[model samples]
Target: MNISEQQIWDLTNQAIDKLGANASPDMIRDYVEKEIANRHGGSLPTEKFEGRVIITAFGINKPGIVAKITGSLAEMEIDLQDISQKIMQNFFTLIMIVDITSSPRNLKEVQEELARVGKELTIKIYAQHEDIFQYMFRI
Candidate 1:
Protein backbone atom coordinates (compact mmCIF):
# COMPACT_ATOMS: atom_id res chain seq x y z
CA MET A 1 0.00 0.00 0.00
CA ASN A 2 1.18 3.52 -0.77
CA ILE A 3 1.06 5.70 2.33
CA SER A 4 -0.18 9.24 2.10
CA GLU A 5 1.32 12.19 3.97
CA GLN A 6 -1.77 12.50 6.12
CA GLN A 7 -1.48 8.88 7.15
CA ILE A 8 2.16 9.40 8.11
CA TRP A 9 1.25 12.46 10.14
CA ASP A 10 -1.54 10.60 11.92
CA LEU A 11 0.73 7.66 12.65
CA THR A 12 3.39 9.97 14.04
CA ASN A 13 0.91 11.72 16.27
CA GLN A 14 -0.43 8.41 17.46
CA ALA A 15 3.07 7.20 18.23
CA ILE A 16 3.84 10.33 20.21
CA ASP A 17 0.66 10.04 22.22
CA LYS A 18 1.22 6.37 22.95
CA LEU A 19 4.94 6.62 23.65
CA GLY A 20 4.78 9.95 25.49
CA ALA A 21 7.50 12.63 25.62
CA ASN A 22 10.31 10.35 26.63
CA ALA A 23 10.17 8.14 23.56
CA SER A 24 13.46 7.90 21.73
CA PRO A 25 13.65 8.29 17.96
CA ASP A 26 14.13 4.57 17.53
CA MET A 27 11.16 3.77 19.72
CA ILE A 28 8.89 6.07 17.77
CA ARG A 29 10.11 4.63 14.48
CA ASP A 30 9.61 1.07 15.66
CA TYR A 31 6.18 1.87 16.98
CA VAL A 32 5.08 3.39 13.72
CA GLU A 33 6.53 0.50 11.70
CA LYS A 34 4.78 -2.09 13.85
CA GLU A 35 1.53 -0.26 13.64
CA ILE A 36 1.77 -0.12 9.87
CA ALA A 37 2.66 -3.77 9.65
CA ASN A 38 -0.19 -4.81 11.91
CA ARG A 39 -2.62 -2.76 9.88
CA HIS A 40 -1.32 -4.27 6.66
CA GLY A 41 -1.58 -7.89 7.77
CA GLY A 42 1.97 -8.35 9.05
CA SER A 43 3.81 -6.96 6.02
CA LEU A 44 5.10 -3.50 5.25
CA PRO A 45 4.36 -1.85 1.92
CA THR A 46 7.03 -2.14 -0.75
CA GLU A 47 6.05 0.90 -2.79
CA LYS A 48 7.52 4.31 -2.10
CA PHE A 49 5.19 6.76 -0.43
CA GLU A 50 3.97 9.60 -2.57
CA GLY A 51 4.30 13.06 -1.00
CA ARG A 52 5.13 16.70 -1.48
CA VAL A 53 8.10 18.48 0.03
CA ILE A 54 8.65 22.06 1.04
CA ILE A 55 11.94 23.48 -0.12
CA THR A 56 13.18 26.75 1.33
CA ALA A 57 16.29 28.63 0.36
CA PHE A 58 17.72 31.94 1.54
CA GLY A 59 20.85 33.99 1.07
CA ILE A 60 22.20 37.08 -0.62
CA ASN A 61 20.47 37.76 -3.91
CA LYS A 62 22.33 36.92 -7.06
CA PRO A 63 21.82 35.89 -10.63
CA GLY A 64 21.08 32.30 -11.65
CA ILE A 65 20.07 31.12 -8.18
CA VAL A 66 16.67 29.87 -9.21
CA ALA A 67 18.01 28.35 -12.37
CA LYS A 68 20.69 26.45 -10.50
CA ILE A 69 18.23 25.11 -7.97
CA THR A 70 15.60 24.23 -10.48
CA GLY A 71 18.19 22.65 -12.70
CA SER A 72 19.19 20.24 -10.03
CA LEU A 73 15.57 19.44 -9.31
CA ALA A 74 14.94 18.80 -12.98
CA GLU A 75 17.86 16.41 -13.08
CA MET A 76 16.22 14.44 -10.31
CA GLU A 77 12.83 14.52 -12.10
CA ILE A 78 11.16 16.32 -9.20
CA ASP A 79 8.19 18.42 -10.21
CA LEU A 80 7.93 22.00 -9.00
CA GLN A 81 4.35 22.38 -7.94
CA ASP A 82 4.54 26.04 -6.89
CA ILE A 83 7.05 28.70 -5.96
CA SER A 84 7.10 32.03 -4.15
CA GLN A 85 10.09 34.31 -3.76
CA LYS A 86 10.95 37.70 -2.36
CA ILE A 87 13.94 39.96 -2.60
CA MET A 88 14.57 42.45 0.18
CA GLN A 89 17.58 44.65 -0.43
CA ASN A 90 20.47 42.22 -0.97
CA PHE A 91 18.79 39.21 0.59
CA PHE A 92 16.53 36.74 -1.12
CA THR A 93 14.19 34.10 0.21
CA LEU A 94 12.47 31.40 -1.79
CA ILE A 95 9.85 28.82 -0.93
CA MET A 96 8.81 26.00 -3.23
CA ILE A 97 6.26 23.22 -3.00
CA VAL A 98 7.55 20.27 -4.96
CA ASP A 99 6.08 16.88 -5.72
CA ILE A 100 8.69 14.18 -5.31
CA THR A 101 6.53 11.17 -6.12
CA SER A 102 8.04 10.89 -9.58
CA SER A 103 11.58 11.70 -8.58
CA PRO A 104 14.19 8.98 -8.55
CA ARG A 105 15.79 10.51 -5.48
CA ASN A 106 14.25 10.20 -2.03
CA LEU A 107 13.86 13.13 0.36
CA LYS A 108 17.24 12.60 2.03
CA GLU A 109 19.04 12.32 -1.29
CA VAL A 110 17.30 15.45 -2.54
CA GLN A 111 18.34 17.24 0.62
CA GLU A 112 21.94 16.20 0.20
CA GLU A 113 21.93 17.36 -3.39
CA LEU A 114 20.44 20.69 -2.41
CA ALA A 115 22.97 21.04 0.40
CA ARG A 116 25.77 20.62 -2.06
CA VAL A 117 24.26 23.22 -4.36
CA GLY A 118 23.74 25.59 -1.43
CA LYS A 119 27.32 25.22 -0.30
CA GLU A 120 28.57 25.91 -3.78
CA LEU A 121 26.41 29.02 -4.06
CA THR A 122 27.00 30.19 -0.47
CA ILE A 123 23.35 29.89 0.53
CA LYS A 124 21.16 27.74 2.75
CA ILE A 125 18.65 25.25 1.42
CA TYR A 126 16.36 23.00 3.34
CA ALA A 127 13.95 20.27 2.23
CA GLN A 128 11.26 18.98 4.55
CA HIS A 129 8.49 16.52 3.85
CA GLU A 130 5.13 18.27 3.82
CA ASP A 131 3.90 16.49 6.95
CA ILE A 132 6.98 17.49 8.93
CA PHE A 133 6.77 21.02 7.61
CA GLN A 134 3.15 21.31 8.69
CA TYR A 135 3.90 19.90 12.13
CA MET A 136 6.87 22.19 12.66
CA PHE A 137 5.16 25.34 11.48
CA ARG A 138 1.67 24.72 12.76
CA ILE A 139 0.25 27.38 15.06
Candidate 2:
Protein backbone atom coordinates (compact mmCIF):
# COMPACT_ATOMS: atom_id res chain seq x y z
CA MET A 1 0.00 0.00 0.00
CA ASN A 2 2.27 2.72 -1.30
CA ILE A 3 5.65 1.98 0.23
CA SER A 4 8.31 4.55 -0.63
CA GLU A 5 11.78 3.79 -1.99
CA GLN A 6 13.39 4.69 1.34
CA GLN A 7 11.07 2.28 3.16
CA ILE A 8 12.10 -0.48 0.77
CA TRP A 9 15.77 0.28 1.52
CA ASP A 10 15.08 0.17 5.25
CA LEU A 11 13.25 -3.15 4.95
CA THR A 12 16.14 -4.58 2.92
CA ASN A 13 18.56 -3.53 5.62
CA GLN A 14 16.50 -5.24 8.30
CA ALA A 15 16.27 -8.43 6.27
CA ILE A 16 20.04 -8.46 5.72
CA ASP A 17 20.72 -7.87 9.41
CA LYS A 18 18.61 -10.90 10.28
CA LEU A 19 20.99 -12.98 8.14
CA GLY A 20 23.92 -12.04 10.44
CA ALA A 21 27.21 -10.29 9.62
CA ASN A 22 28.66 -13.17 7.58
CA ALA A 23 25.90 -13.09 4.93
CA SER A 24 27.24 -12.95 1.38
CA PRO A 25 26.47 -9.98 -0.85
CA ASP A 26 24.69 -12.07 -3.46
CA MET A 27 22.58 -13.72 -0.78
CA ILE A 28 21.57 -10.35 0.59
CA ARG A 29 20.65 -9.07 -2.85
CA ASP A 30 18.59 -12.16 -3.68
CA TYR A 31 16.81 -12.09 -0.34
CA VAL A 32 15.86 -8.47 -0.71
CA GLU A 33 14.59 -9.01 -4.28
CA LYS A 34 12.45 -11.97 -3.28
CA GLU A 35 11.08 -10.20 -0.22
CA ILE A 36 10.01 -7.21 -2.27
CA ALA A 37 8.45 -9.39 -4.96
CA ASN A 38 6.51 -11.39 -2.38
CA ARG A 39 5.07 -8.19 -0.98
CA HIS A 40 4.14 -6.54 -4.30
CA GLY A 41 3.38 -9.38 -6.72
CA GLY A 42 6.60 -8.66 -8.66
CA SER A 43 5.26 -5.53 -10.36
CA LEU A 44 2.75 -2.80 -9.72
CA PRO A 45 -0.07 -2.25 -12.21
CA THR A 46 0.10 1.07 -14.07
CA GLU A 47 -2.27 2.85 -16.44
CA LYS A 48 -1.12 2.48 -20.03
CA PHE A 49 -0.74 5.67 -22.08
CA GLU A 50 -0.32 4.85 -25.74
CA GLY A 51 0.10 8.45 -26.80
CA ARG A 52 1.90 9.77 -23.80
CA VAL A 53 3.28 13.26 -24.42
CA ILE A 54 5.67 15.20 -22.26
CA ILE A 55 5.39 18.97 -22.42
CA THR A 56 7.90 21.42 -21.03
CA ALA A 57 7.31 25.15 -20.86
CA PHE A 58 9.41 27.94 -19.51
CA GLY A 59 8.96 31.72 -19.56
CA ILE A 60 8.72 34.75 -17.36
CA ASN A 61 6.68 34.08 -14.24
CA LYS A 62 3.15 35.37 -14.32
CA PRO A 63 -0.35 34.48 -13.20
CA GLY A 64 -2.86 32.53 -15.36
CA ILE A 65 -0.13 30.72 -17.29
CA VAL A 66 -1.04 27.32 -15.83
CA ALA A 67 -4.74 27.86 -16.43
CA LYS A 68 -4.09 28.83 -20.04
CA ILE A 69 -1.86 25.84 -20.72
CA THR A 70 -4.17 23.34 -19.07
CA GLY A 71 -7.16 24.91 -20.74
CA SER A 72 -5.67 24.01 -24.11
CA LEU A 73 -5.49 20.38 -23.03
CA ALA A 74 -9.09 20.46 -21.88
CA GLU A 75 -10.28 21.79 -25.19
CA MET A 76 -8.52 18.97 -27.02
CA GLU A 77 -9.84 16.25 -24.67
CA ILE A 78 -6.28 15.38 -23.63
CA ASP A 79 -5.80 13.93 -20.16
CA LEU A 80 -3.35 15.76 -17.94
CA GLN A 81 -1.92 12.93 -15.88
CA ASP A 82 0.83 14.79 -14.04
CA ILE A 83 2.12 18.36 -13.87
CA SER A 84 4.81 20.27 -11.98
CA GLN A 85 5.76 23.93 -12.18
CA LYS A 86 8.21 26.10 -10.32
CA ILE A 87 9.28 29.70 -10.30
CA MET A 88 12.84 30.86 -9.76
CA GLN A 89 13.26 34.61 -9.67
CA ASN A 90 11.22 35.82 -12.68
CA PHE A 91 11.58 32.60 -14.68
CA PHE A 92 8.93 29.89 -14.63
CA THR A 93 9.34 26.23 -15.60
CA LEU A 94 6.56 23.74 -16.12
CA ILE A 95 6.61 20.08 -17.01
CA MET A 96 3.54 18.04 -17.77
CA ILE A 97 2.87 14.42 -18.73
CA VAL A 98 -0.36 13.99 -20.65
CA ASP A 99 -2.30 11.13 -22.21
CA ILE A 100 -3.26 11.99 -25.77
CA THR A 101 -4.67 8.65 -26.84
CA SER A 102 -8.25 9.82 -26.62
CA SER A 103 -7.70 13.21 -28.12
CA PRO A 104 -9.48 13.88 -31.41
CA ARG A 105 -6.49 15.84 -32.71
CA ASN A 106 -3.28 14.27 -33.94
CA LEU A 107 0.16 14.80 -32.38
CA LYS A 108 1.28 17.31 -35.01
CA GLU A 109 -1.88 19.34 -34.61
CA VAL A 110 -1.54 19.39 -30.85
CA GLN A 111 2.06 20.52 -31.00
CA GLU A 112 1.19 23.20 -33.48
CA GLU A 113 -1.58 24.53 -31.25
CA LEU A 114 0.74 24.51 -28.27
CA ALA A 115 3.30 26.41 -30.31
CA ARG A 116 0.69 29.01 -31.06
CA VAL A 117 -0.11 29.33 -27.39
CA GLY A 118 3.55 29.55 -26.50
CA LYS A 119 4.05 32.43 -28.87
CA GLU A 120 1.09 34.24 -27.42
CA LEU A 121 2.31 33.73 -23.89
CA THR A 122 5.95 34.51 -24.67
CA ILE A 123 6.97 31.05 -23.44
CA LYS A 124 8.70 28.16 -25.15
CA ILE A 125 6.71 24.89 -25.20
CA TYR A 126 8.02 21.59 -26.41
CA ALA A 127 5.98 18.42 -26.85
CA GLN A 128 7.50 15.01 -27.40
CA HIS A 129 6.80 11.32 -26.95
CA GLU A 130 7.33 9.82 -23.51
CA ASP A 131 9.83 7.29 -24.83
CA ILE A 132 12.19 10.08 -25.87
CA PHE A 133 12.02 11.51 -22.39
CA GLN A 134 12.81 8.10 -20.84
CA TYR A 135 15.74 7.56 -23.20
CA MET A 136 17.31 10.97 -22.67
CA PHE A 137 16.99 10.76 -18.88
CA ARG A 138 18.04 7.13 -18.48
CA ILE A 139 20.90 6.62 -16.02
Q: What stretches of model 2 exceed 4 Å from their correct place?
A: 1-49
TM-score for each model: 0.63, 0.62
The Cα local distance difference test for each model comes to 0.91, 0.87
Off-target runs (Cα >4 Å) in candidate 1 are 1-49, 136-139
TM-score of 1: 0.63
The digit string of per-residue lDDT tens for model 2 on 14-97 reads: 876788888898878878777766777775333444679999999998888899999999999999999998999999999999
Q: Please name the candidate that would achieve the greatest TM-score relative to the true structure.
A: 1
Backbone clash total, candidate 2:
0
